[model samples]
Target: MKIKVLIADDHQLFREGIANLLFSAENIEVIAQAQDGADAIEKAKHFKPDVILLDIAMPVMNGIEATKKLK
Candidate 1:
């Protein structure tokens, strides 16, 4: 089965670049993308991705805070 993934980053170009790279992988899928930590949490709850690629610094909320809330 393909591994579902969610990527969260404030940088649009970076996020899209990562998503594209993951999408090219046969065993992985880019399921969703988020602009910040809060958005990542919301998407995670809804999508329940197998993995999350998150940035440490972001607007609204940061990766560390988001990880705490998710856990």
Candidate 2:
């Protein structure tokens, strides 16, 4: 099965770049993208991706806090 992935970052270019890179991998799938930590949480709950890539610094909530909430 393909590994589902969720990417969360405040930078549009960075987020899209990562997503593009992940998409090149046959075993990985980019399921969703979030602009901030809060959006990441919401998408996580909905998509339930196998992996979540977060930016340490973001608006609304930081990666550390989002990781805690997700846990």
Predicted model with the maximum TM-score: 2
Cα deviation of 48, candidate 2, in Å: 0.5
Backbone Cα, N, C clashes tallied per candidate: 0, 0
Q: What is the C-alpha RMSD of each candidate to the true structure, in Å?
A: 0.5, 0.4
lDDT of 1 by residue, 1-71 (tens): 99999999999999999998887899999999999999999999999999999999999999999999999
Every candidate's lDDT? 0.97, 0.97
Where does candidate 1 clash, by residue pair? Answer: none
Report the C-alpha displacement of residue 56, candidate 2, in angstroms: 0.4
By lDDT, the best candidate is 2
Candidate 1 global CA lDDT score: 0.97
Model 1 per-residue lDDT at 45: 98
- Residues 1-71, model 2: lDDT tens digits: 99999999999999999999988999999999999999999999999999999999999999999999999
Residue 17 in model 1: lDDT: 98
Q: In candidate 2, how many Å is residue 29 off?
A: 0.4
